[model samples]
Target: MLPPILRLLATPLPLPLVQGMAQASLTHILREHPGLFDRLGTFAARPIAISPTDAPFDFTLVLARRSVRVTRRGATPPAYATRICGPIVLLLALAEGRLDGDAEFFGRHISIEGDMETALALRNAAESIPLDFVRDLAPPWRWAQRPGQAVLGAVRRSLLEREGVPCN
Candidate 1:
């Protein structure tokens, strides 16, 4: 189970607020890593549905266009070329390259459906980046970035420890 803070922040929040935040997050990430999409090659155009099993919503990732569409669970979602479902913590760890994708997949911690190639391509693209979710996702300001990183890093380390993964 996710921590109460995460549940409280995500579960009852308004959908549009969550979606707008998600979209802005994608934009911020792309701005920080300009080559992220280009690294995906032709697979960048493919739509990938990222479903966080523990979250209240799913994210349809549009890497080519540097956009993300957030949809509430149980709602009709847009068509995607592939779907990847996992716990939100694991998914975030995977995106940050903190966990190996193959190990998780083989261990059944994550499930993938639809196009296998697209999934692989997406995984490769994510692994290629050295992403510090704390620093990357935080506002791009000198003062805020450092404090944000410190707090988020501690939170992430706690989460990973609970998941039995050592935080570097």
Candidate 2:
């Protein structure tokens, strides 16, 4: 019931406004984390896209020297994109900066296609940060930040037993 309502509400939002906000957030994140661009420079020229299967969301990430924006459409076909095909909980766990990308991939929760190298770089950049990405979210989301870390810790422990040393 709530899902449909949420979608209906979100569907009416102006794309430009949403993109601007997303860009601002990404820019802020980059500014907060120095050396991130140096690592991401390889893929900065090429657009990065994130496609979430849960909704009609296709965010084409535009990363520049001083700005980043999540555009609604990609200017060109991407060699690779992060496919968020799992439950939204997976994303929450990731935002907390705990869930292992290799674990998620082997666990069949997420996938990156086309340019595997860039995807690897993206993962490295994301995990390099010391702070929880969820911290940047509104107050309402703070509770989940801690639990998300816990959930990822549990997954990490289990993965350690099944598969030694999961990637970040």
Candidate 3:
């Protein structure tokens, strides 16, 4: 289970509020470091749409103007598809040259749709940005914060425990 604080943070907020927050955050980052996303170039103009299949959950992230749609379904080839969740994370990892791309992290459980090549291209483009620098762009309450690491660790432990696997 997620901690109360995290649950609150992740709670569904009004769409306007969510959009405002995202825009504000992005704007801040861009203003603070104009070159941060320069490498992204056209990719930043693209939009990535994420939707949870079999559910009403859906969102979109416009990168450089390209649109990549991601969706989650009970049974599908690309189970969890979203540029934010999959491509973004993967790109970040790749950019840092730490791309484990572990099946455990993004397994058959998630799927990618539309412009697989573009997604791959974005991954290559992200190579210019350092992961640490990217992490530095978020706010304190952001998931990139230390608390988020703790939460991820707890979740990993819980998953391992449930699977009867010893967690380190």
If scored against the real structure, what TM-score would every candidate get? 0.93, 0.63, 0.47
- Please, what are the lDDT tens digits per residue for candidate 3 over residues 83-113? 4333333333333455433342465423556
- Which runs of model 2 end up more than 4 angstroms from their true locations? 1-5, 65-89, 137-168
> Could you give candidate 1's per-residue lDDT for residues 52-146 as a string of tens digits?
88888989988888889989889988899999999888998998888899999999999999999999988888888777788778767887887
Q: Highest TM-score: give the candidate number.
A: 1
Off by over 4 Å in 1: none
Weakest ten-residue segment in model 3 by summed lDDT: 72-81
The Cα error of candidate 3 at residue 23, in Å, is 1.2
Model 3 misplaced regions, further than 4 Å:
1-9, 32-41, 50-58, 65-98, 101-106, 132-168
In model 1, what is the error at residue 95, expressed in angstroms? 1.4
- The deviation in Å at residue 40 for candidate 1 is 0.8
Give the whole-model CA lDDT for all candidates, comma-separated: 0.86, 0.57, 0.46
Clashes per model (N, Cα, C within 3 A): 0, 0, 23
Which should have the higher lDDT, number 1 or number 2? 1
